[model samples]
Target: MKNQEVADLLREIAEYLEITDVPFKPRAYQRAALVIETLAEPIEDIWKAGKLEDIPSVGEGIAKKIAEYLEKGKSAYLKKLKKELPIDADALLSVGGLGPKKVKILYKTLNIKNIEDLKKAAEQKKIRNIEGFGEKTENTILEGITFLQKTENRISLGFALPLAESLKDQLLASKRVHTAEIAGSLRRSKETIGDIDLLAASDNPKRAVEAFLTIAAPKALLGKGEKKCSVILTSGMQVDLRIVKREEFGAALQYFTGSKSHNIALRNKAIKKGYKLNEYGLFKRNKRIAGGTEDSIYKKLGMAFIPPEMRENLGEIQLAEKGSIPPLVKLKDIKGDFHTHTIYSDGRASIEEMIKKAESLGYSFIGISDHFGHLRIANAMDEQRIKKQWKEINAVQKKHPKIKIVKGAEVNINKDGSLDIPPAVLRSLDYAIISVHTNFKMGKQEMTKRICDAMEHENILVLGHPTGGMIGERKPYEVDFDEVVLAAKQHNIALEINSQSKRMDLASPLAKAAIEQGCRVSINTDAHYPDSLEFMRFGVGIARRAWAGKADIINAKELKQKS
Candidate 1:
């Protein structure tokens, strides 16, 4: 199991312990789980090195449990807890705003075993009758249920991408498989995907299919055939695999890796040219033509090769036809990350650690944009602490002359369109990233004005997480995005595409709009831990989906030169 999976299991154990009224151990487990999740090295590796207790917050008891979990597939303590609770803890906790205490109340009072039971209770008005749950709470529960149902079939890109890669690797290892690739929405880099689609080029389709089944050992076989196979993984993710001859692989890939609208557009183009386009191959007057490669297929259609991310029927076809499709920003285009946190704020790693991580990633520069003092919950830095951080950053700069360290703060935007940091202090930093941390209920006009006013500040270089959204959990705050985009253009401030999995803010659509408005974007991980900096790839994905090229992103250029 992966470190993240182990961490999640431990976290679930903590939740179940809390619900069961276990004292002290629940909080201990919680702390250990957090450390495990953020650890740079795998917990299993630590255990193999016989240093399980070396992990912070992990003590003898927790270490033993972790060892048991890693050695076997399950933890004895966790299994015992599950047997005692006899409730679907994950399902109960999946409800938005529902915590261990709430789940306990529901389980003990209403006999709510899972989501279905909770939904029934809410619908029958039984939830309101419970001591703490009012009519408002009941309605909120219903809304959360509806949201869960809507997103149940979909998995976040971050979650699905790695699994797809692992599957592709397994397929490619088979002697019968010549080439393998993940397709569908995943290939398009969609933020969320319903299922994983895999395509392989192989001469022996039956052997390839059998090898996949043997390696995957899926929980259930949904279907099986020489050309196509479907299965449900142990993690409950559905996967579909298709194998085709090397000669027809390109056409099959194009057919399957489709946004329905994009495929329809291509078919229409083919019809106009008196040709036929399908999964088998592109045909002209019953003669097989180009099908061996994606480039060949596009060439046959007399168009430039459109990137999968741009194949959403969003004017990409026209651009391809005219051979004017701009180059999309690649992960390598990012020279630095302008928004990151360290121990000065709510971040887990120290400034030196973050800089080292960035340097290891081959970054020429990195920014330490920790939270400013206004965010009390994060224990954000005050003026004195900010100056102290700059001192430390300067020292690090001297030590690591190869990586330019940009000193900055993520200043909170107050309700009245004012910044939390004083103007003089903000100006002292190399640059400032302004963001909204609270007052999300402001009307569209108020929010827009608040952001626009912040952008007007001389020190602000980028607006972080411009939409103030947490995908699948919270909706974007009300704001006139057009006004914000225009303001960003006017003030020469870049809008950020936050790379945090939960908040891919300035989401692709808004990022595209910002680019069209002559506003550049800053792709930042908004990373709290050094490891989180790797999320930059997700930000780049969003930029590509927005059709943003290197020139459209500020961080793609050297910050020192711009300064």
Candidate 2:
């Protein structure tokens, strides 16, 4: 979908508007950009339906700009704004904490136009002398720059997966294309993708390649041949497309959808069996066999089919050979989400709206776990507000009796192993998720004790975003996860796998450790908006990577009332 493309343009416009001292227009554009990002359908589809103005927070002006972008693949006003500013505004804003205001200040004060310039300034200690930036801010900028350098080429799975799916859909539309599938790290469901790899089966390779090239609209055609083509998209993602005959499709898919180690292990197994395995087919004594399907190929090698996510060569092959691979959790296995927020706290959607969205997704129950009083910045619910929220939830329960709505709060864990909310208030709710939102710099022993104490609270049900990492932007806070897992097991508190794209905390490895340590895991979106609920798939992917089964996840079962 062109949703991300349009959102990027709108955000760029917002940044430029902020630099130009425009009143309120920048915020309007920013809000519109956020709304566009969360939209399920393509922005072009909305424009085609003549209902761009129907989108929330998008008015006439932004609608016109979006229409221009969809029709021409560029916005004239955005171009004009870029030309006027004449700086690498996007590059400057790529730093974690560097907002448009900071970008403007850097540009005006030190003539910093890009990351290189900013890095040089920070290294020279010039930024600390600026009006608002001090030594601490300078050090943070340097750290952000380092982080940006490390992750600049790596795109998150959440962003790359949709783009790859769209490309596959476009390729499948062609009459010449028989079947198309994404391969490489994408198929393996890696957290970050380096590039997109696609494979298609077709009778006419040339025709399929032509159709792919036309749809891709490459900024630069890297190469082209009768059976293979490589191109760089305008969005700077490289895609490699290859077309093979139907007979070779499965072999080709298995060969390409690989971790190097997995393929090598499979090849060794094939060699021991006096067979040769490659992209074309598996061969014994130069006679082709077992290339028509992945299942057939695995059967010929005397092993069960290994799921792509488990093909990380992390003992999966041995398990497959032994026929003991456990069933990984699937999206359909989840009965409901135990961790979610609403308009009562930091969430954008109201309680009714969240419940309705969950019902639409076939969930039988959902918990409204909003922020508690400690997260003052989120405008958290106090005693009175909590009572009002429960009253509203009761009203909704009467109206929507088919789905269960559990009232809960995401109570903050204080530094000295105490919960931010009173025990009485916590006990009054259905359950509570005790989380650490601040004081991330606490020492390992202190942090472990704090989390363990929170887990001891009778009202605490789950530990939310266990590690408090923001992917590439921020490092996970220091804590002895082994001790934390032991405590969770002892206290019967579930550790959460937060599915927000930015913070997939309690990441796959940690989740796997918790499961192995006999602590049940909760896979939650920690969704603040209705659209964010869809992020559950990413969480499921992490769980699969962790080799977590349905029974290992708490939310996979029907909701039961706490004693």
The C-alpha TM-scores of every prediction are 0.90, 0.94
Q: What is the C-alpha lDDT of each candidate?
A: 0.86, 0.87
Quality of model 1 by C-alpha lDDT: 0.86
lDDT tens digits, residue span 512-539, model 1: 8889878889999888777778888888
| Candidate 2 positional error at 546, Å | 0.8
Encode model 2's per-residue lDDT on 212-328: one tens digit a residue: 999888889999999999999877889999999898888999999998899999999999989999998899988888887787899888898888888888899999999888899
lDDT of 2: 0.87
Off by over 4 Å in 2: 19-21, 374-377, 415-417, 441-446, 561-563
Highest-TM-score candidate = 2
Error of 1 at 130 (Å): 4.9
| TM-score of candidate 1 on Cα atoms, chains taken together | 0.90
TM-score for candidate 2: 0.94
- Which one is best on lDDT? 2
